[model samples]
Target: MVRKKFSKKEIFTGIACTLFALLILSLYVWHQTESVSLGYDSAELEYRVTQLEKEVEKLETIKSSLLTLDRVENIARDKLKLSEPKEEQIVYEHIEKER
Candidate 1:
């Protein structure tokens, strides 16, 4: 069996190469982790947007139903005991628009 002795330069080169490879691998792993985390956040935000849109639609439907003319007329006639104006009590006006 032959014994081989390595020089100081060779040992230092090997250590430096190993450290550089480790640093590159660490950077790659960190980048991949950030990408995955951002993907999850984007999906969560999209789901939140969809939920908000649905809520807005539901609120608009409720507003429309509440503002119906039939309901308002019923409330006005029955609750306020108001009657229609007579022909003598009515007046008409004409207005000109500015250009």
Candidate 2:
């Protein structure tokens, strides 16, 4: 049997095709890794947003409780040592509006 010799053009073409296939494979792998990273980042951000929403709701509840009339009156009477005015000490004022 005679050994067949390869041409220079055939060898170059083979090498180039191999290199291109490797490049395409690398790019695909890189894109897959980047997609996974972005997915993890998005999930983390979503969790943080949920936590912040819960915190906002908790703060709103505390604010509402602090603003109640009974709480305010208790704080003023106990902490500030203030008292309501007697009925005899109350006064009324009248104002006239211009048309």
Candidate 3:
């Protein structure tokens, strides 16, 4: 049987290469994890945007209802005890514009 011995230079080169390969593998894993995390964050942000859009639509609907002329008239007549003016209470005004 013959036994072979590796030289110091060869051993050092092998160890360095192994360390470099490990470093690269770790970097690749870290990058992949970061990419996945960012993907999840982006999805969450998209969901939030959708929720906000829905809320905006709801608020707009409420605003429209509140601002309707019929609603205002009802509030004025019922709550404020206001009524339409009589024919004798009406008046007309004319204004002239100068160019």
Candidate 4:
């Protein structure tokens, strides 16, 4: 039996098939590169989350410290100089409007 030579249409069809397969492979690689599954991007995100959690804990500690009775009383007495008033020394002044 004689060997049958490939026709031009058949050769072009083979090239098209190869190019299509290559295109599909390239698309797959592109998708995988953009996705964050088991990659450096995921690790970076996890690290950022951990840092944010630590900052939140620090802020909470500072907030609790500020709310203590000692801190409140110290600020009030030092800054405002408020004191208990004696009943006999207490006086009220009435202001008159100028015409």
User: Model 1, range 1-99, lDDT digits (tens) per residue?
Assistant: 998899999999999999999999999999999999999999999999999999999999999999999898888899997778999887564432331
Q: Between 2 and 4, whose TM-score is larger?
A: 2
TM-score of each: 0.70, 0.73, 0.70, 0.65
Candidate of highest TM-score? 2
How well does candidate 3 match the true structure in TM-score terms? 0.70
Instruction: Give model 4's TM-score versus the native structure.
Output: 0.65
Candidate that beats the other on lDDT, 1 or 4, i.e. the better one: 1
The worst-scoring run of ten residues by lDDT in candidate 2 lies at: 90-99
Off by over 4 Å in 2: 1-3, 7-9, 86-99
- Cα TM-score of candidate 1: 0.70
lDDT of 3 at 6: 96
Q: In candidate 4, which residue ranges exceed 4 Å CA deviation?
A: 1-5, 36-38, 84-99
Clashing pairs in 3: none
Please give the CA lDDT of all the candidate structures: 0.92, 0.94, 0.94, 0.87
Instruction: Report the lDDT of model 2 for residue 25.
Output: 99
